[model samples]
Target: MSQFGKSSAKRSKPSYLYAIIGVSLILFLFGIVGWLFLNLKKSGEMFRENIQVHAYIQRSATKKQIDSLQKYIEAIPYVKNLEYITKEKATAKWNAENDTTWKKFLDNSPLPESMDFYVKSDYMNKDSIASLQSELEANFGGRVMSEFQYPTETVGYVSSYTKYIAAGILLFAIILSIIVIISIDNTIRLAMYSNRFLIKTMQMVGATRSFIARPLNVRAVINGLIASGIAILAVFCFILLVEKFVPWLKLLRDGRNMAIIITGIIIAGVTISYASTHRSVLKYLKMKLDDLY
Candidate 1:
């Protein structure tokens, strides 16, 4: 009886150990996914804001010429919006921006009317913006337009480098997810193997494979749910901590996007756990005890 009690206790320990390990793995996986999502979201937003194309109209450009140019630029597919600043308005804006240097520039001459072209969010990049600038210069030419101004040095490099970084992070996350799933499945399989003798006994008595697999399946799903719930809670807490310390880290400032990301995380967690557990259980069911060694 004491020996049976000792064996029962031993059996219980493995389940608890497996549950702990599973939970830890889930948390790690969730962290990686959340980090990648946040980085991509923030980088994308910054990219959109930094992309701008400025068309400086010639000082002698007539009102009709300015209006016609604005209309033509607005019709472009990649153009999100355009703002027309008259010479007087641009001068006032510049004066207001630089109060100290206002007098120095005010004596020289009037500023030219300028059209600020904001490209569509996704279309903001070196290649697209450069193409749009070239097309504008070709169509309008230097007669009506004095010059085009865009900070290619800083914005171009930052936007391109960020895109590459985001792509690399996404690829890394995918590879990491595959590795994590396989590792978890193997761990679960080893845990199940410890009970192979009992499984064999049940099978010998004419228990169907489904019946034998039911309890393990149920436990796996429950474990997955618990692990996922904990991981999400941890992520939320971490976000809160970041907000407290670094208030600028507002990736999910929009309530709708925040909800969507949270939903995605939960779904990913559950799906990974379900697939890994199902595969591990199925593998064990097909194995013979002699091969188990």
Candidate 2:
């Protein structure tokens, strides 16, 4: 009986090896897609945060009012990189960008003092900015203009493009995940095929279902871990190789996101492997000796 079991296991050895390799490749591809999604999200956030919103101060406003407005805007949760741009500074900035200085055209600078700031990525949208503008105007009265200005077209374009890209990636990831699960299940079932006769022989000799399944289940867990480990190593190496060429991708490294991806891959591998193996074992045990042949 032991000799028979050993012979069955040997027959399944090649299939087991192929299953591990197949699962590892699938997992590696999934990990790569996850990493790409994370990097895209981070990059979008950085781009959105760079958009500068200029809240021009009323020229007739007093120093106290200007300072109060600056403090108030700075205190807002969505605000970042807040700066109180005085009239002189604003004029200098304008001149630096334009070919001619304002002094060449006029005696006094026509530029207004402003509260230049950026909003957090979460609030970097048309509706959010409009709401923020309303809130600021209601709170500050006439200290700062209600008509805050920024690149509205740029914001709209960024937001629309980001949503489309994110949706596309999400859809692709979902499809790929389903494919990976099915592929892993099929691979595991094929590996279990060679042991069908062995399972029948053991069952005929009074082996309980649990007794026949426990060892195979344990082997399944080990193989799952091995596949997960290989996939993780491959992902790490691929990232390192890519970053070496496109160094800017290294800037988007997010430890928390990467950790989540790793944990997900590990769980997927082990859970799918164990479930598929045990399911296949039970399936074979239910079949008659003739069916096994």
Candidate 3:
């Protein structure tokens, strides 16, 4: 009876190991998704800010008028970057993009000197672009020969597509979060089961509830930290691999974002592990001995 009543714990419990492995894999996956999302957002902004709106200059415009127009556009709050493209430069660019020279198809370069500029990400909208065009025309008078021209249809499609992708990613994130919680909870409870009889034995020996809970909680914290560290290592390795394969992703890596995701993983691991263990221990402590079996 004494042998039966005494808690016989294995010197090494594989339950905790299995739990940690499972949690680590899940955490690593979450980390990768978060990293990708951050980069996608940054890349999207880069693409938007690079969509240049070309304001063609009048062929007869004076150098003073051109310089003044360039200076005025540069001063606009919404403009991110501005460049004055001479007729020669415009023809060269058009040739490079289309594989033919403008002068070959027409008498002289019909292309006018242009103020080519990109707007800030926040201003990359139909209304904003239109307002900018109107303002430039109004301010520069005839020196601004035509409306600022950009690919409105392409911009609208890309905007709509990314919004849908964002929605899908957000939905997946929420669902994955819930799964991680449940998975951690179940894992902790299974691990605590090995100590259930020990908890009741302590209760039988006049140990207070806090006394029974404290050591397990401490162990949970240690386990959580170790698991989180392992996950971080795996995630870092995965990032290195991705950087090797798709080198451009390295350019988008932000220190602040990486730190936040890693920190969040650590916090979530510790909190979930400790809370789940404490709850399981409390639950077993309250159960009748017959019910524990």
Residue lDDT tens for model 1, 1-293? 44553664478467647754665566656564756476567657666765677899987777788888899898997776689987667877886786646566567545777898777666677777778778878888686788888887865776677778778878877886677666655665666656655665566677788887787667667766666677677777777886789776674356655566567556655565566656655666677867656
Give the range where candidate 2 is weakest over 10 consecutive residues by summed lDDT: 139-148
TM-score of each: 0.78, 0.92, 0.86
Error in Å for residue 114 of model 2: 1.3
> Clash totals for all models, in order?
0, 0, 0
Clashing residue pairs found in predicted model 2: none
- Between candidates 1 and 3, the one scoring higher on lDDT is 3
lDDT of 3 by residue, 1-293 (tens): 35645424552267778778877877787788878877787788788888888888887888998888888888898886788899789888888888574456787877778888888876786767878778877887575555568989967866677779779878987997888889888888888888788888889999999998998899899889988998899989999998999998888888888898899789878999999999998999899999999
Which scores greater on TM-score, model 1 or model 3? 3
* Candidate whose TM-score is highest: 2
User: In lDDT terms, which candidate is top?
Assistant: 2
Ranking by lDDT: 2, 3, 1
Per-candidate RMSD, Å:
4.0, 2.0, 2.9
Off by over 4 Å in 3: 1-12, 98-108
Tell me how candidate 2 scores on lDDT: 0.88
Give the local distance difference test score of model 1. Answer: 0.69
Error of 1 at 61 (Å): 2.1
